[model samples]
Target: MSNHSSSTISAFGYEIIRDHILSSVLGKHENEVLYWAGKELARKFPCRTIEELVAFFVDASWGMLELIKETKDGRTFQLTNDPALMQIGYRSFRLEAGFIAEQIQQIMGYLTECYDEKREKQQLITFTVKWDVKERIQNTIPNE
Candidate 1:
Protein backbone atom coordinates (compact mmCIF):
# COMPACT_ATOMS: atom_id res chain seq x y z
CA MET A 1 0.00 0.00 0.00
CA SER A 2 1.26 3.45 -0.86
CA ASN A 3 1.65 6.06 1.87
CA HIS A 4 0.56 9.04 -0.22
CA SER A 5 -1.89 11.33 1.50
CA SER A 6 -5.06 12.54 -0.20
CA SER A 7 -6.05 14.83 2.65
CA THR A 8 -3.71 17.71 1.88
CA ILE A 9 -5.08 18.64 -1.52
CA SER A 10 -5.17 22.41 -1.65
CA ALA A 11 -7.75 24.38 -3.56
CA PHE A 12 -4.96 25.83 -5.73
CA GLY A 13 -3.54 22.40 -6.45
CA TYR A 14 -6.91 21.11 -7.47
CA GLU A 15 -7.49 24.13 -9.66
CA ILE A 16 -4.11 23.73 -11.29
CA ILE A 17 -4.52 20.05 -12.00
CA ARG A 18 -8.16 20.36 -12.99
CA ASP A 19 -7.51 23.30 -15.29
CA HIS A 20 -4.61 21.52 -16.93
CA ILE A 21 -6.52 18.28 -17.45
CA LEU A 22 -9.66 19.98 -18.72
CA SER A 23 -7.80 22.29 -21.08
CA SER A 24 -5.38 19.67 -22.37
CA VAL A 25 -7.20 16.35 -22.27
CA LEU A 26 -10.82 17.46 -22.38
CA GLY A 27 -10.20 20.61 -24.45
CA LYS A 28 -12.11 22.70 -21.95
CA HIS A 29 -12.02 23.89 -18.42
CA GLU A 30 -14.39 22.11 -16.06
CA ASN A 31 -16.37 25.30 -15.56
CA GLU A 32 -15.51 27.46 -18.54
CA VAL A 33 -15.84 24.49 -20.86
CA LEU A 34 -17.37 21.24 -19.54
CA TYR A 35 -20.02 22.85 -17.38
CA TRP A 36 -21.03 25.32 -20.05
CA ALA A 37 -20.91 22.58 -22.64
CA GLY A 38 -23.44 20.58 -20.66
CA LYS A 39 -25.60 23.65 -20.25
CA GLU A 40 -25.48 24.48 -23.95
CA LEU A 41 -26.38 20.94 -24.89
CA ALA A 42 -29.24 20.95 -22.43
CA ARG A 43 -30.60 23.99 -24.20
CA LYS A 44 -30.36 22.36 -27.61
CA PHE A 45 -31.92 19.15 -26.29
CA PRO A 46 -34.99 21.03 -24.94
CA CYS A 47 -35.09 21.36 -21.17
CA ARG A 48 -36.72 24.56 -19.99
CA THR A 49 -34.88 25.52 -16.79
CA ILE A 50 -32.13 24.21 -14.59
CA GLU A 51 -34.62 22.04 -12.73
CA GLU A 52 -35.78 20.43 -15.95
CA LEU A 53 -32.18 20.04 -16.99
CA VAL A 54 -31.57 18.21 -13.74
CA ALA A 55 -34.72 16.18 -14.20
CA PHE A 56 -33.54 15.15 -17.65
CA PHE A 57 -30.35 14.01 -16.02
CA VAL A 58 -32.34 11.99 -13.55
CA ASP A 59 -34.48 10.56 -16.36
CA ALA A 60 -31.36 9.35 -18.08
CA SER A 61 -30.38 7.88 -14.71
CA TRP A 62 -27.16 9.84 -14.76
CA GLY A 63 -26.81 10.15 -11.03
CA MET A 64 -28.88 12.81 -9.31
CA LEU A 65 -28.38 16.52 -9.10
CA GLU A 66 -27.52 17.16 -5.49
CA LEU A 67 -26.76 20.80 -5.94
CA ILE A 68 -27.46 23.26 -8.73
CA LYS A 69 -26.76 26.97 -8.61
CA GLU A 70 -26.32 29.55 -11.37
CA THR A 71 -25.71 33.19 -12.03
CA LYS A 72 -26.10 35.62 -14.91
CA ASP A 73 -22.62 34.79 -16.16
CA GLY A 74 -22.81 30.99 -15.71
CA ARG A 75 -24.16 27.98 -13.85
CA THR A 76 -22.91 25.15 -11.70
CA PHE A 77 -24.58 21.76 -11.56
CA GLN A 78 -23.53 18.60 -9.78
CA LEU A 79 -24.47 14.93 -9.98
CA THR A 80 -23.21 12.07 -7.88
CA ASN A 81 -23.08 8.31 -7.72
CA ASP A 82 -23.74 8.61 -4.03
CA PRO A 83 -26.10 11.26 -2.82
CA ALA A 84 -23.99 11.64 0.31
CA LEU A 85 -21.03 12.88 -1.70
CA MET A 86 -22.69 16.01 -2.87
CA GLN A 87 -19.55 17.63 -1.56
CA ILE A 88 -17.03 15.37 -3.28
CA GLY A 89 -18.37 12.95 -5.89
CA TYR A 90 -20.47 15.26 -7.99
CA ARG A 91 -19.33 16.57 -11.36
CA SER A 92 -19.80 20.20 -12.39
CA PHE A 93 -20.10 22.61 -15.37
CA ARG A 94 -19.88 26.34 -16.11
CA LEU A 95 -20.36 28.79 -18.99
CA GLU A 96 -20.31 32.54 -19.72
CA ALA A 97 -23.66 33.03 -21.38
CA GLY A 98 -27.15 32.51 -20.02
CA PHE A 99 -29.46 30.73 -22.45
CA ILE A 100 -31.43 27.53 -22.67
CA ALA A 101 -29.59 26.46 -25.82
CA GLU A 102 -26.25 26.40 -24.07
CA GLN A 103 -27.26 23.73 -21.62
CA ILE A 104 -29.13 21.76 -24.28
CA GLN A 105 -26.18 21.85 -26.63
CA GLN A 106 -23.67 20.59 -24.10
CA ILE A 107 -25.94 17.98 -22.51
CA MET A 108 -25.12 15.28 -25.06
CA GLY A 109 -21.67 14.91 -23.58
CA TYR A 110 -23.20 14.19 -20.21
CA LEU A 111 -25.64 11.84 -21.89
CA THR A 112 -22.73 10.22 -23.68
CA GLU A 113 -21.69 8.74 -20.39
CA CYS A 114 -25.16 7.41 -19.73
CA TYR A 115 -24.26 3.80 -20.43
CA ASP A 116 -20.70 3.99 -19.22
CA GLU A 117 -20.68 3.42 -15.46
CA LYS A 118 -22.61 0.18 -15.69
CA ARG A 119 -20.37 -1.38 -18.33
CA GLU A 120 -17.77 -3.89 -17.32
CA LYS A 121 -15.51 -2.74 -20.11
CA GLN A 122 -15.97 0.68 -21.57
CA GLN A 123 -15.53 1.99 -25.11
CA LEU A 124 -14.76 5.46 -26.32
CA ILE A 125 -17.58 7.35 -27.97
CA THR A 126 -16.91 10.18 -30.35
CA PHE A 127 -19.13 13.24 -30.22
CA THR A 128 -19.55 15.19 -33.40
CA VAL A 129 -22.20 17.75 -34.23
CA LYS A 130 -23.01 20.97 -36.00
CA TRP A 131 -20.67 23.38 -34.31
CA ASP A 132 -22.12 26.27 -36.20
CA VAL A 133 -25.86 25.83 -35.81
CA LYS A 134 -26.90 28.68 -38.07
CA GLU A 135 -24.35 28.03 -40.80
CA ARG A 136 -25.29 24.38 -41.14
CA ILE A 137 -28.97 25.21 -41.43
CA GLN A 138 -28.15 28.00 -43.88
CA ASN A 139 -25.98 25.77 -46.06
CA THR A 140 -28.56 23.04 -46.48
CA ILE A 141 -30.80 24.58 -49.10
CA PRO A 142 -32.40 22.02 -51.42
CA ASN A 143 -32.03 22.88 -55.07
CA GLU A 144 -33.65 20.65 -57.64
Candidate 2:
Protein backbone atom coordinates (compact mmCIF):
# COMPACT_ATOMS: atom_id res chain seq x y z
CA MET A 1 0.00 0.00 0.00
CA SER A 2 1.09 3.56 -0.60
CA ASN A 3 1.40 5.87 2.42
CA HIS A 4 -0.10 9.13 1.21
CA SER A 5 -0.24 11.84 3.88
CA SER A 6 -0.97 15.46 3.01
CA SER A 7 0.43 18.71 4.52
CA THR A 8 0.40 22.51 4.14
CA ILE A 9 2.19 25.72 5.39
CA SER A 10 0.37 28.54 7.16
CA ALA A 11 0.17 30.96 10.12
CA PHE A 12 3.07 30.78 12.41
CA GLY A 13 4.35 30.58 8.88
CA TYR A 14 7.99 31.37 8.07
CA GLU A 15 7.11 34.04 5.47
CA ILE A 16 7.68 37.03 7.77
CA ILE A 17 10.73 35.46 9.36
CA ARG A 18 12.22 33.84 6.23
CA ASP A 19 11.93 37.15 4.43
CA HIS A 20 13.63 38.91 7.31
CA ILE A 21 16.33 36.24 7.51
CA LEU A 22 17.02 36.28 3.80
CA SER A 23 16.87 40.08 3.46
CA SER A 24 18.18 41.37 6.76
CA VAL A 25 20.52 38.59 7.84
CA LEU A 26 21.12 36.58 4.70
CA GLY A 27 21.01 39.80 2.64
CA LYS A 28 22.35 39.48 -0.92
CA HIS A 29 24.28 36.49 0.34
CA GLU A 30 23.73 33.96 -2.40
CA ASN A 31 21.97 30.80 -1.22
CA GLU A 32 25.52 29.39 -1.04
CA VAL A 33 26.84 31.98 1.43
CA LEU A 34 23.89 32.02 3.90
CA TYR A 35 24.43 28.28 4.10
CA TRP A 36 27.48 29.42 6.06
CA ALA A 37 25.20 30.50 8.90
CA GLY A 38 23.04 27.40 8.43
CA LYS A 39 25.83 24.94 9.26
CA GLU A 40 26.39 26.77 12.54
CA LEU A 41 22.70 26.60 13.35
CA ALA A 42 22.60 22.87 12.65
CA ARG A 43 25.51 22.19 14.98
CA LYS A 44 23.74 24.00 17.84
CA PHE A 45 20.86 21.50 17.63
CA PRO A 46 22.78 18.36 18.38
CA CYS A 47 21.26 15.47 16.47
CA ARG A 48 22.83 12.01 16.71
CA THR A 49 22.50 11.41 12.98
CA ILE A 50 22.38 13.65 9.91
CA GLU A 51 19.02 12.04 9.09
CA GLU A 52 17.75 12.97 12.52
CA LEU A 53 19.28 16.41 12.13
CA VAL A 54 17.57 16.92 8.78
CA ALA A 55 14.32 15.61 10.22
CA PHE A 56 14.73 17.87 13.24
CA PHE A 57 15.20 21.07 11.24
CA VAL A 58 12.38 20.35 8.77
CA ASP A 59 10.08 19.34 11.60
CA ALA A 60 11.36 22.16 13.81
CA SER A 61 10.22 24.82 11.35
CA TRP A 62 13.65 26.47 11.34
CA GLY A 63 12.76 27.75 7.94
CA MET A 64 13.20 25.19 5.11
CA LEU A 65 16.29 23.37 3.94
CA GLU A 66 16.34 25.02 0.54
CA LEU A 67 19.90 23.87 -0.10
CA ILE A 68 22.78 22.16 1.74
CA LYS A 69 26.49 22.33 0.95
CA GLU A 70 29.90 21.56 2.41
CA THR A 71 33.17 23.14 1.35
CA LYS A 72 36.69 22.73 2.71
CA ASP A 73 35.36 24.85 5.58
CA GLY A 74 32.00 23.18 6.60
CA ARG A 75 28.56 21.84 5.66
CA THR A 76 25.20 23.68 5.53
CA PHE A 77 21.55 23.39 4.52
CA GLN A 78 19.81 26.26 2.65
CA LEU A 79 16.25 26.26 4.01
CA THR A 80 13.31 28.33 2.77
CA ASN A 81 9.53 28.22 2.26
CA ASP A 82 9.69 26.09 -0.88
CA PRO A 83 5.98 25.12 -0.58
CA ALA A 84 7.19 21.76 -1.80
CA LEU A 85 8.38 20.95 1.72
CA MET A 86 5.23 21.99 3.59
CA GLN A 87 4.40 20.39 6.97
CA ILE A 88 2.13 20.53 10.01
CA GLY A 89 3.28 22.42 13.11
CA TYR A 90 3.19 21.02 16.63
CA ARG A 91 0.86 22.56 19.19
CA SER A 92 3.21 21.51 21.98
CA PHE A 93 6.80 20.47 22.67
CA ARG A 94 5.99 16.83 23.40
CA LEU A 95 4.17 16.36 20.11
CA GLU A 96 7.10 17.90 18.32
CA ALA A 97 9.30 15.24 19.87
CA GLY A 98 7.70 12.02 18.64
CA PHE A 99 7.07 13.55 15.25
CA ILE A 100 7.79 11.33 12.26
CA ALA A 101 9.68 12.05 9.05
CA GLU A 102 8.13 12.95 5.68
CA GLN A 103 8.60 11.53 2.19
CA ILE A 104 9.19 15.00 0.81
CA GLN A 105 12.66 16.29 0.02
CA GLN A 106 14.99 16.90 2.94
CA ILE A 107 15.12 20.63 2.02
CA MET A 108 11.92 22.67 2.17
CA GLY A 109 10.44 26.09 3.09
CA TYR A 110 7.47 27.71 4.94
CA LEU A 111 4.23 29.48 3.86
CA THR A 112 2.09 32.42 5.11
CA GLU A 113 -1.41 31.20 5.94
CA CYS A 114 -3.49 30.97 9.18
CA TYR A 115 -5.22 27.87 10.56
CA ASP A 116 -5.06 24.94 12.98
CA GLU A 117 -5.78 21.21 12.93
CA LYS A 118 -6.13 18.04 15.01
CA ARG A 119 -3.24 15.88 16.10
CA GLU A 120 -2.57 12.18 15.66
CA LYS A 121 -0.03 12.17 18.47
CA GLN A 122 -2.52 12.65 21.32
CA GLN A 123 0.04 12.18 24.15
CA LEU A 124 2.03 15.19 22.88
CA ILE A 125 1.85 18.83 24.00
CA THR A 126 1.41 20.79 20.81
CA PHE A 127 1.49 24.58 20.79
CA THR A 128 1.71 27.16 18.03
CA VAL A 129 4.97 29.09 18.09
CA LYS A 130 5.67 32.75 17.32
CA TRP A 131 9.34 31.89 17.71
CA ASP A 132 11.66 34.87 18.20
CA VAL A 133 13.96 35.37 15.24
CA LYS A 134 16.88 36.46 17.37
CA GLU A 135 18.87 33.26 17.85
CA ARG A 136 18.85 32.74 14.10
CA ILE A 137 21.02 29.64 14.43
CA GLN A 138 22.62 27.79 17.30
CA ASN A 139 25.59 25.40 17.82
CA THR A 140 23.33 22.41 18.46
CA ILE A 141 19.72 21.25 18.47
CA PRO A 142 19.13 21.23 22.21
CA ASN A 143 16.33 19.20 23.81
CA GLU A 144 14.46 22.45 24.40
lDDT of each: 0.37, 0.34
Which regions of candidate 1 deviate over 4 angstroms? 1-24, 49-51, 66-80, 83-144
**What TM-score does prediction 2 earn?**
0.33
Mind giving the per-residue lDDT tens digits that candidate 2 earns over 1-144?
Answer: 544334545544555454444457644453444343443444354455547655665666543332244333223333343332233242211222222111111122111111112334332122222222232333222454
Give the top-scoring candidate (TM-score): 2
Model 2, residue 30: distance off in Å is: 5.3
Question: Relative to the unseen true structure, what is the C-alpha lDDT of residue 50 in candidate 1, on a scale of 0 to 100?
Answer: 55
